[model samples]
Target: MSVTRHKVWDPLVRIFHWSLVIAFAANALFTDPESNLHEWIGYVVVALIAIRILWGVVGTRYARFTSFPPSASGALGQLSDIATGRKRAHLGHTPLGAMMIYNLLLTMLAIGVSGYMMTTNAYWGVDWVEELHEIFVTWAEISIVLHIGAVIWESLRTGVNLPRAMVSGVKTVPEGIKIEP
Candidate 1:
């Protein structure tokens, strides 16, 4: 198969992607819930996501939300393609991937807001708030796992190295593949 490299992810997008990954992972796995480090990291996570939301509005061609708007029918179509053993690649984010991006973005926002709430006198020592925060974190953890699995699955199915693309800002898609815009 012939190969063609597309500059799909810009540097800011890549940085935000990896930084979010690291910050989320640290908070989820390493940091103590009551520690100052955990709270600081939570703020960092919120800030990164805030910047990403702005970037999605005015970023590069493929980085903008317009490039990969979330669509339910499109996501269903992607699932149908998978079930039919059809290999279609997306030049940027696939519809399903876009949905996940939106999900994760909203989830992170929930986690951040809930986390922040826990810090306030109003919410401090409130059991429901703590439970809600934990629930959001759990959902984020599950979503992250699924995201990784989908990336690997799509990469293998479409002959694309998705993780590498995220890291290096390029998608070396195989030539002649059916690419969804």
Candidate 2:
């Protein structure tokens, strides 16, 4: 079977993805919430999200939000493909993947905002804000795990090295596989 290369992720998008991954992983797994370093990392994450938000507006084709508007029907179709063992390659983000990306971005913002509020005099010791921050973090963590698993599963199912594609900014699609744009 022949394989074709498609340029999907731009350099900025790839950098944002991996940078956010490292920053989020550091804050979630290794840093103490009480430490200034943790706060700084949160700031970095917030800034990264902001940059990503801007990029989503005017970036390359696949990086723009319009390229992958969230669709319940599309997501359901993707699930159906998975259930039926159908091999389909998506040139950009899959319907569910786009939703997860949005979810993660918003969750990160929530975590950042709540975290900042906690340090302010107005919200100092505010139980709800702290709890909300923790809740957002937990949600983001869960979403991340699902995202990774889906990437791996999709890669194997479609004969695409999704992780490699993310790293290299290109997707290699096997011949005869139905492609979704």
RMSD of each: 0.8, 0.7
Model 1 worst lDDT run, 10 consecutive residues: 172-181
Residues 1-181, model 1: lDDT tens digits: 7898888899999999999999999999998889999999999999999999999998898989998998999999999999999888898999999999999999999999999999999999999999999999999999999999999999999898999999888888888788777
The 0-to-1 C-alpha lDDT of every candidate, in the order given, reads 0.93, 0.95
lDDT of 2: 0.95
How many residue pairs clash (N, CA or C atoms closer than 3 angstroms) in each of the candidate models, in the order given? 0, 0
Candidate 1 lDDT: 0.93
TM-scores of all predicted structures: 0.98, 0.98
lDDT of 2 by residue, 55-134 (tens): 99999999999998999999999999999999899999999999999999999999999999999999999999999999
